[model samples]
Target: MKAYLILEDGSMYEGKSVGADKNVVSEIVFNTSMTGYLEVLTDPSYAGQAVVMTYPLIGNYGVCYDDKESNRPWVDAFIVRELSEFASNFRNEDSVQNLLKSNNIPCISGIDTRDLTKRLREYGTMNGMIVCESSFDMAQITQRINEYRVKGVVKKTSTEKIYTLPGNKKRVVLMDFGAKKSIAKELQKRGCEVIVVPYDTCAADIINLRPDGIMLSNGPGDPKENTAIIKEIKKLYDTDIPIFAICLGHQLMALATGADTYKLKYGHRGGNHPVKDLETGRTYISSQNHGYAVDESTLDKNVCVPAFINVNDSTNEGLRYINKNIFTVQYHPEASPGPGDSSYLFDKFMKMMED
Candidate 1:
């Protein structure tokens, strides 16, 4: 069926509907990754937003079960420049269309996704709607776009209750800030007994568990708004157990340590951000999302910044605790839907546990 996307700004693009026959409206954003579309679709971080793939041809390899970052697709909608019909990969068990159809997600293809990406870059991400071309109404579409809500995104995506993966190697407690399942899988792969707690779990409760380490997971929303978590992290700061964080987690860690964070006018929301490691002078291309970052100037007097700024935007990407076994990165080391350049951080966490 003929489909068209109507942005809040009244800009429209025509396309073909490839998945379920339904209208979808969401805050539209874009990703620059050339591959890993399945992982991107399934990641909880993309919840409540429609994702536009910058790469012209998508679904060339089809969808495979093993590539999922979460239990199911969380994105509100999917858009691409072209939709590959043929399933080419050896592990392909489901076509991309079938995958989205099964999940009841609305998808639009055969559009100028590059143009959409350009608009997002220029105007920052904004709410939009994918509708049947025959039913388009500018006023209704704009009203729907304005009504889109991206708040409380973490709660909508997080697990309803506690869950556990059995392991005895090391007890790791993860604060679920809309965490992807891959984070749990990574800990399980390391033989760590992973206990995933709710985002609002008290510091005393976590300490009572006597975990070998604690992990602050990536989530949606401004880090400064989560005041309780900041207070909680402060109580754990002096603990001897190793503490590691990622993305939003990293921002919260900085806040908990008396640092401040600020929102970017046009935030980093793509997969190709380049980050440098100040300790080793090594640079790695990283995947990132979120609109706010810790202000390096507000760091504690003795605190040290371990990660250099993103080369393109000069935003903070990593930090370390002075004389303490604590650190965090403003990128995805689990990298369920992007490059694995920073995966070594996982091994570093393991080594920290050993020490």
Candidate 2:
């Protein structure tokens, strides 16, 4: 069915609506990944937003049950330039259309996604609406987009209760603010006993678990919104246990360590970003998706800059404690739907645990 995408800034684009035939209003952001649409759709980090895939041809690899980052689709809606009609992978269990249809997530295809991406790149992320067969009144959609509320996304995506992933090696306590399961898999794969807790978990409660290490997890929203978590992290900072974080966790670490954070004009959301290690001058292609970044000036002078300069924009990418075992990356080291270039960071975490 024919559809119209109206932005809060009074911009409008027409396209064909696929999947669930319903209207959606969410923060519209574009991703540059050529693959992993399924992972993007299911990622809890995408919750409360509509995603526009910059890759022209999507769903060609088909959808597999095993590639899911979360239990279900968290995105408010999906936008694409093209939608594959046929499932084409060996492990294909279903078509992308069927998966979104089954999950009640709306998608609009056949739009000029590249142009949309360019616009977002220039104007920054905006509230947008995907309406099916509605009267093409840009004013109404724009007003609706302006009225939408955008807070509490992280709480909505986070697990309501604590859970555990058992292992026999080093005891690791993970604070899951909508963390990807791949993180636990990495820790467990390295023989760590993983205990996954909810977002509201306290520092004393975690320390009482007698863990050898603490893992702050990735999730949605600005890190400054998580005041309690920042306080919790502050309480844990003086402890002797090792700490590791990724993405949102990285932001929280910065907040805990007296660093400031600010949102990017249009955040990094792709697999091909290059990050350079400041000390060693080594570079690694990374997978990233977050709008906020830690302010380097807020970092302690004694602290070392392990990773620096995201090639797309020279922003901070990683941080390591001055004389401690705490470390974090602003990009995904687990690399669920992307490259494994930064995966060695997990091994380094294991080394810290072993020590």
Best candidate according to lDDT? 2
Query: Can you write out model 1's per-residue Cα lDDT over 1-355, one digit (the tens) per residue?
Result: 8989999888999989998888888888887788889988888878878888888999889989898877889888999988999979899989889989999999999899877888888987788998966866678778888998777777777677777889979999999988977788888889999999988888999999989999999987767778887899888887888999998889988988888899776577666889888878888988877667888888875965656578887788989888888889988887766778988898899899989
Please give, for residues 1-355, the per-residue lDDT of candidate 2 as tens digits: 8987888877788889888998889989888888888888888888778999999999888899898888898899999999989877799998999989999988899899988999999999988999987675666767789988567877888788877887888999999887887888899998889988888889999999999899988898888999988999988887888999899999998888788999889898888889998878989988888888988877776754546678768899988788878988899988877899988988888889889
* Clashing residue pairs for model 2: none
- Segments of candidate 2 deviating more than 4 angstroms: 303-306
How much lDDT does each candidate structure score? 0.85, 0.86
Best of the candidates, TM-score: 2
Q: Which ten residues in a row have the lowest lDDT in candidate 2?
A: 300-309
Clashes of each: 0, 0
TM-score for candidate 1: 0.93
Query: All candidates' TM-scores?
Result: 0.93, 0.96
Clashing pairs in 1: none
